[model samples]
Target: MIRITKELSFPLENILFSFALKSEAADVFDGHNTLITGIGKVNAAYELSKAIQHKKPSLIVNLGSAGSNYFQKGDVICCSKFIQRDMDVRGLGFEQYETPLSNLPILLEYGFEMEGLQTGICGTGDNFEMGHNTRIYNVVDMEAYALAMIAMKENIPFLCLKYISDGADDNAADDWMIQVHKAAVAYGNILNLNKNNISI
Candidate 1:
């Protein structure tokens, strides 16, 4: 794991938020620690791997924008389960989205409640094109599962929040590019409700 620690120190449980794009977190957090891990599962895993090992915060939160066919734009959702959408090797008797030989199912679960947010599983991949999964209410993102998996491995309490930016479709790429900034601002304002702003 690459160590990317800040010189500043804080108490335990200091919330560390990871975002794949700055637009997703630029203003979402006031004073809490945040990082732009770039877009895609590889970048997410690589950056987050370093983050957790270096800081070792009590909790990890991944906040970002997603495109969904079922969810409407601007709706904040809690990512309760994570599935690696591209992990398919059923030909060899592995289950869909199942991590091979690791006993770690590609489907990872984390349940945490927040008001006005729907709980949904996030299907993660490096590709932005939308596709199918066993889950019904799912969010399409490029980074959530990788971050969640790392968080799980490190035994840190984790939560993922997403704001739907577009319907996953031919227009999704363009729409997401335009909507993410506004979504970030809205998410940041929502954080105001946290008061202490660092709940698990």
Candidate 2:
């Protein structure tokens, strides 16, 4: 049970920037309060939880690389809705993507909507989506859902910005390797441009 304080004056100082890998962050977030939560939901949840315990942030901003079929490569998308793509328990009379007996909705909607940015429904899963059969989500990532969940539980404002590194196809691995390094630059530009305009 981490307590959040509303005394922070600067917006950037009160923001907790989260990433799944150091490669995704690069040197853009050099001196800021950034957390590299490794990969996947478990790591994302554990690392973010630990960080919040030390100091609760007013806002949790998740910046990462993601694969998408609907959006083009090199596009930066603002995601407000999240889904656990790997959660499937239809066999147990539970709805698809629903957490069994948890009372959580299949699509968890909570995040700041940035102006002039395209919004997307992000599907977070353990597996790297190469085929991407469903139209339910346009963006696919490995950790945003867990981070978003923690932020929701903590009553903290959350924002997720995903850079499209691949097209979620057979060439996704190669494309991701090439485009992932550019995510930091994209995020940096967006933040710098909107730093004064962003309310949360």
Candidate 3:
């Protein structure tokens, strides 16, 4: 859990910027308190839990790149709802996306909805989606669900912003490699515009 900003300042001091990878965030969020949680659900959950234990933040803002079949590339989406796409325990009489005996809902809807940004339902899974066919979620990522769950458990406000880097199809890998670098720029612009105006 590395803090990108050396000196914590006002407005952003209470806000924690969470990213799955450093490449997704780049250096655009240098002046803010950022946590590079690595990739996937386990890493994200562990790192964020450690960060919270060390210092509880008022808001946890997750910014990263994602693949989407519904959204176009270069679009910055605000994801207020999250679902674990890989959680399938239907054989045990549990609903799809439900954590068995956890009492958590199938869909976890908890995040700040940013004005002027397109809202999306983010599906988080361990594997990279190459052929997304589910209509339940419009966006697919590797970490947002775990991060959101932690925030929900801790009673911390959460905000998720995803940059559409690729379409979840055969061409996803190649497209993601090319467009992922631009995620930081798009996030920078969104945060800059909302930093002062938004409550979260």
Candidate 4:
């Protein structure tokens, strides 16, 4: 088991890097313990949560590609807060995205900082939502919310980093495919910069 302390200077080896797709992490993080969690929230939540329970890394760093109308293509942003955009059960006297009974029902936050990375609000859904957006969330993804929520429940420090691959337009698929590799490389740079942040 890994211990969480006030000091934030752990070796990169103790950090578990996660990716939704292998190609999204290709040529990057070649020698690290990166988790390729398939795609979407179910895969990420089940796999990552299981791993966290078993291995208990000091930190989890989720890196992948995302769609955005505001963030520039190839821009890597840190997800400090996450929300589930696809959950709509307001008819039952609850908010649309609220994860019922949780302390922070609709939102989960990762309390940490990374130098040279801008904190962004990320929204996750099962489907790839194109052109559907809100001003509150700049990044749209498929896995970050589930990953962050699980980490919070497990009391593990989590950081989500994403590269903007598309503009939430019709051309998003093609753009995502083309830019996934680039995003992977950029994610590597962040790991190198903050290698000591993960607890050894």
The list of candidate 4 runs beyond 4 A from truth reads: 1-7, 193-200
Arrange candidates, best TM-score first.
2, 3, 4, 1
TM accuracy, model 3: 0.90
> Considering summed lDDT, which 10 consecutive residues are worst modelled in model 1?
1-10
Q: Which ten residues in a row have the lowest lDDT in candidate 4?
A: 191-200
Question: What is the Cα-based TM-score of model 1?
Answer: 0.83
Q: How would you encode candidate 3's per-residue C-alpha lDDT over 72-161 as one tens digit per residue?
A: 999999998999999999999998999998988899999777777899999999999999998999999999999999999899888889
Residue 161: error of model 3 in Å?
Answer: 0.4
Question: Candidates' lDDT values, in order?
Answer: 0.74, 0.88, 0.87, 0.79
Expressed as tens digits, the lDDT of each residue in 69-136 for candidate 1 is 87788888888788888888899999888888988866678635455677788888788864433454
Question: Which residue pairs in model 4 clash with each other?
Answer: 10-198
Off by over 4 Å in 2: 1-10, 193-200
- Give the number of the best model, judged by TM-score: 2
Query: Hey, what RMSD does candidate 2 come out at?
Result: 5.0
Candidate RMSDs in Å, in order, are: 6.4, 5.0, 5.5, 3.9
Q: Which portions of model 1 show Cα errors greater than 4 Å?
A: 1-13, 28-31, 131-137, 193-200
Candidate 2: worst-modelled 10 consecutive residues by lDDT? 1-10
